[model samples]
Target: MSCSDPRGISLGPRQIADGVYWVGVNDCLKDLFESLWPIPDGVSYNAYAVVGSEGAAIIDGVDEHLTYEYVEKIREVVGDLGRVKYIVINHLEPDHHASTPRLLELAENAVVLVSTVGARILESLYRVPRERIVEVKDGERVSLGDKTLRFVYTPWLHWPETMMTYLEEGGVLFSCDAFGSYGALVRGIFDDEVDLDYYLEEAKRYFSNIVFKYSKNVLEAVDKIEKLGLEIRILAPSHGPVYRKRISEIISLYRDLSLPKPCARATVVYGSMYGRTEEVVQTIERVLERSGVSVDLVDAARTHPSYTLSLVAESAAVVFVFPTYDASVFPPVREVINYLHVKQAGRGRLAAVVNTFSWGPSAKEAVDALSRAGFQILEPVVSTKSLPSPEDRRKIEELAERLSSELRKFGSCA
Candidate 1:
């Protein structure tokens, strides 16, 4: 059984395990996710359905805009909508649970399951009432005939009330947003069926952009699960792949990203208005490349902060180059820095600043911004006027050399 979307692609529920189907929706039409992050590769709002001999439950929901398509997918899987007994809301984020209210209208027999705190704000967020909502505490379990599900309170998984639902018999963990990625499923939905490399990389970006801010919470959640001795045979996140074969790999990656054992890579981000700062960035990029130091360059003026944050997450070092504007750090660069600071980025990283100005240098503004973002600013902040003179070029080289040497010292010996 298949369902149609605006892209003319046939997407239907794929049985990920016995009695468990991935009834998710992919939105290829949205240019931007949440109207901010760029989704050039598109993204999926994944949901799942679990059927037992006695009852059926669906985990998560898609965006409200595609209510009909999502409901149709549910129908395809369950046949009669009345058979749907439970609508499990792991997280109350709109992209995941926005379709719940509409689903509730049809599934008259269904009762909404959510976290205790989720119950408080459920009505305010989706207008789902308390009567239909059953708030679950941590370690609480509900059985649907032969299959059993447990709720674990994993708060601050980017939201205060977020939780993950664990299926007992099959050992499936429907992690709400953890281990999520940006790309939509194409050839298949499971790790074995899709391109593992692409999804894993996207998962890294997704973690950095969405979940890494609450890395401590992620670690706690993982630890909690381990202490419970729950065998998570499958990682059924609300987005991206349903990891079965590579369960340990995904879990290990999240732990590393959570602790943020940063690689010896660097991110060179800059906004050049009149090409002077561009000259410095080009010089730095060349030096980094020559040293065999893996690096990512982001043009802050053109690229969104959503991308910049992801690039910076994996980098052990960040070099910010920008021209001073209005006697302050360049607006675009400043904005990116602010976003990083707000997200508590730069936990284990080094930073360098290069400023170009027509009159007085604004190198201090850039340095102060990075400092507020928790970066350890390296020495020799380079500043140039109009264009880089011989002295400015020499200082730029020194800074690049220092950064490259630092990367090598941090285990990226290559």
Candidate 2:
């Protein structure tokens, strides 16, 4: 699908379901998402417009930078701005609601709808009169003539005030940032129209980087939906393509990602100030490969933590190889460990350490960090002096054998 539109919009407003139009914007200009994770495929800020028999509502808003085009897309769907009576904010993250100020200016008659927490936080972010803000509770229903909007509280799906809007008549769930992905929707608007393979990986990466920390909350939110028995026909997230044909597939994928199960693969996350530590890593990789163990080798100096977090979170075992520096852990390796903790990637996982030092052997720092991150440290915390000697190489091979044996026991989740 071509990603160009004559009006400079990446995609024109497209219909996802009856009376529900996608007013999302593809942001190819930004190199990163949240000024952190890289977005080589770009990202999308998805918004939606739901037209009812009596009144119209816009679900979420695009980034502030895309305000003009966003409002224009709404105009394309709603025709008259005055017809918009509600601006439902599922999540108030700037990426989703930054353009709301300008959008409210255009739709002067529209009232802002938010959850209880959203009401408190939205006031801090935007200037809206008390009468204009309607705070809804979980399971609360708002009437839009023929269509009814149900609010489901799904906090920490990245933020405290996050929630989802369910359209009763259309069986559409407007989940902002919950079932989201990173890549821009350049191909098409719906899941059936786009390439599923590419978007799924982007979604996994998005989950690993952004939502993995609140994975328990994500599972809770999913359970809430299940217990309530909400039949979601269309999953309209704040980013990526809308899921219509494969709603169940994305929902299942999200559930699996949220629950950290042991996969057979191992992720080798390492940092090397010099060539010494990398040489040890090479030996370990070769042994693991020859033993028929699948491995993902990530150089902490070169790879971003977001990508590594994705691999480590799913892998059953994670091996850290870094040289001790200044009588402490290597800085880059420490950064990766910090991110692993924040992402909760080490929870219920096995970890091993290979420390190389020219002066002092400082395996304490690596062990403490990994233990704090909830990794079950394996035996033989191999420490070497600068580079591996013949004896050190034997120890390394022993460590590899242990890892290979343990990895074989843990089955793959792929």
Candidate 3:
């Protein structure tokens, strides 16, 4: 049911339920998300239009560039844009509210609904007028004749003012960024409509890149949903698919990621010069594999931080192999560690540092950084000279064995 547009191309508003329309836009052009994470597969800004008999409410907004398409989608569904009563800002992030100002100008009758914290910052961020803003609290309900929009204040969901909107009648939870992923919707919006496995994997990467640092907050948000007894038949997030058939799987995915029951795999990240560090990396992988441990090797200089973080975040153990450059840890290797520390990864996970240096020591730098990032490092910090001498190779094997044994304790080994 796609149609051509007068101004440009539009996916149009495809209804997911009786009165709810998916009025989102795909952004496949941006190379990097948040100017940090690489999103080669692109991303989507999923907004919604919920129409009741008397009035209509628009849940979330798209990136600033797609303002026209978003507004047209709303107009397509609601006919008279003035009939829109509430422009709900589930999260104050610009991706979800960039078009709020323009939409506000179009839908003159609508007032902006945001959380108490969101209200305070909306004017500053989006130049939205305070008079047009309405502050919503946890469990607050706004009636739109036949449909009722309930707000759950789920703060610290990667943002302090984040909250979710529940359509009380439809069992649809318009979760803002909690279950978001980083893929543009090419086929359809529902979980079963598109490739579920691809989106689910993207969801994991999105969690590691965006929401992992606030894992505790994520757990609290999930618990809040359970305690409130919200019958969430559909999980409509701000990014990626609208989960219907696989709602339970998506919910459990979020819960598990927050608790971070890492999979039975290990990631080996190496930054090598002169092939010395690579030598140790390969040997370690072989040993781990022989010991019944699955291994993923990542070249720190070649792999983007987005993929690296995703791989490292879900693995049971990590082996960092790098050579000392200028008597310090290699720059590329150091960058990965910084991201791990910033994103709050490595917590309760095992890590082993393999260092090769021509001069003074550099293993201590990696050891300290990994420890700060919450990794339980294996003992003796494997250090070697310029190459793998007989003694150095023996130490490398010993380190791999220790790491594999610790991974075995986690019950991941075959």
Candidate 4:
């Protein structure tokens, strides 16, 4: 759906079983990409409605603007908005909790369910009443009629209070952001019904932008869930469309991302003051490409950090090219390097540093930062002043040779 559609409400009511439904609220926030840290294509806010014999329960709520539409859809399906007995806040993220206050007011007797950490965040952030909150521990189950809702605490899957809710009878897991992506599924909400390639790209972008930093915690949380041995018939995440089939594939994808899998490729990202460092990056790209190694040339000034992190996560090596200014690497390149270090993105990868300066120790300093970040240095760093002479080119060739050798070793392992 176009962004400007005033009635841009895309909702889904997929029946899980008798008297149960998976309600998907699509693209609840308008212009979600504009607000993302490094920007995204778009995103959806998925909320589920579970109908039972006694009453109904809404798993999560969309943003303020979409709450009324969400309430209306529930009323349409269940015949009454007042019958919603529980509002389970799987995550207190704004996209999921912004409309919660209004929903609680409408649901009257419906209790707001969340983890203790989630409750604290909601009270501090949204001023949600403490008495209305129902704190659930990990593996805690709450019965809503014939179906039981089980809460699994998954902290730092991007946020501390994040958790997943599973419908015991339905075998549907409402994963807040664990297997989520950007972009709403306009026509359908299941993986089998949509274009897998497009969704996978969005998923990668989402993980790269929002979840890559907390990858360690993600792995731990995934392991915890696996130990529970719940029969997962569908994977419903808050941001992206649901996975009604191939649930194992999505779980495997997340598991793989949590592990280290490096390719025999190098990404040379550089920021240049003038043409000097740019020349070096171009030379390195050509040198690597000629040796039958894949290379990605990213101008740090133009490429976003999210895409760069993705490439770093996939590559066997990363070459940082910088122009020295006042005994420091260029700001953009420096920022990227620092982020990579902080996120530990260069794990199990070879790295090399190159710098262009009039006369300074900036190249050595930049190389030191990469070394401290746990990158295995493949060669002595290359530095140039004014322009590279034949000797400088020869040094670059040697550095390229060292890098190629490292990649060859990595290839043999693969």
* Top candidate by lDDT: 3
Off by over 4 Å in 4: 1-18, 28-34, 38-40, 325-327, 342-348, 359-361, 371-374, 412-414
Worst 10 residues of 2 by lDDT: 1-10
Report how far residue 279 has shifted in candidate 1, in Å: 2.3
For model 3, the stretches where C-alpha displacement exceeds 4 angstroms are 1-10, 262-264
lDDT of each candidate versus the true structure:
0.86, 0.87, 0.88, 0.77
Q: What tens-digit string does per-residue lDDT give for candidate 2 at 319-362? A: 99998888888887888889988877446688889999987988
Q: Which residue pairs in model 4 clash with each other?
A: none
lDDT of 4 by residue, 101-195 (tens): 88788778788988888877777768667788889998898887787889999898877988999899888899988888777666566787666
Candidate 1 lands at a TM-score of 0.92
Model 2, global lDDT = 0.87
- Superposed on all Cα atoms, the candidates' RMSDs to the truth, in angstroms, are 2.9, 2.3, 3.1, 3.0
Top-TM-score candidate index: 3
Model 3: what TM-score? 0.95
Superposition error at 227 for model 1 (Å): 2.5
Instruction: Estimate, for each residue in 218-290, the C-alpha lDDT of model 1 and write its tens digit.
Output: 9999999899999988899988888989999999999988886655699988998777777778889999889
Comparing 2 and 3 on lDDT, the stronger one = 3
lDDT of 3 by residue, 111-191 (tens): 999999988877778877768899999999999999999999999999889999999999999998999988888777788
List the candidates' TM-scores in order. 0.92, 0.94, 0.95, 0.89
Candidates in descending lDDT order: 3, 2, 1, 4
